[model samples]
Target: MSVSQQVIKDKLQASIGDIYHIIITDTSNGCGQSFDVIVVSDTFEGKNKLQRCRLVNGALKEEVAQIHAFGCKCFTTAEWSKLVV
Candidate 1:
């Protein structure tokens, strides 16, 4: 079974809380086995890179286990604002 992009996006929003922005991409060409993601949230404000990764991984624990590959870049709203500017 494969995961849908919406499922992942929804789960992150539900689990992470206070999401300011999010982008989810299907990287497996419809196989749903791989994804590339970016999440911007206040929940990440005080967290480091590893901590952010762990939070995202924990939120998507089951999905991550089932998928062949998953890549996520997490940031605080402040960090994201800087990047987009």
Candidate 2:
């Protein structure tokens, strides 16, 4: 994990409570060469995917600027569990 990852994870942890899991994949160049983040948290509550992703973006504003592309899969714990069901 990079500094940005830790900073992001810490900020997210504060707002979301216990994180079920977090996965960050560092990809290649161009727009596709971006970080793909999957965050599972209870704090997502009534937020839609866009809202949850926006929140994460807000939390990592600086980091976002440093990268060319950004991608995220945000999920509430309940939503994530349902995916496995």
Candidate 3:
């Protein structure tokens, strides 16, 4: 069975907390084999890109194993503010 975008969003939100936004896109021709994710949260503060990626990877460990492609962009609240404005 494949996971829905809402399920992915909920799981990340539960693990990371204090999220400004969570966007998950299914990019596998509707097969649910690939996903692109953007996560904005205060939990990523003080973490480097790799560290932030690791945090997301850890949160979605089991789900990722089933996916063939996973692309993630993570940002802190401050970083997101900078990017948006």
Query: What is the C-alpha local distance difference test score of each model?
Result: 0.92, 0.74, 0.88
lDDT of 3 by residue, 19-47 (tens): 89988999998888899999999889888
User: For model 1, which pairs clash?
Assistant: none
- Compared with the true structure, the alpha-carbon lDDT of candidate 3 equals 0.88
Best by lDDT: 1
| Regions of candidate 3 where Cα sits further than 4 Å from its true position | none
Worst 10 residues of 1 by lDDT: 1-10
List the candidate 2 regions with Cα displacement exceeding 4 Å: 1-7, 14-16, 29-33
TM-score of each: 0.94, 0.75, 0.91
In order, how many clashes per candidate? 0, 1, 0
- The sequence of per-residue lDDT tens digits that candidate 1 reaches over residues 1-85 is 4589989988998899899999999988998999999999989887889999999999999999999999999988889999999
Q: Which ten residues in a row have the lowest lDDT in candidate 2?
A: 25-34
Question: What's the lDDT for candidate 1?
Answer: 0.92
Query: Against the correct fold, how does model 1 do in TM-score?
Result: 0.94
Question: For each candidate, C-alpha RMSD in Å?
Answer: 1.0, 3.6, 1.1
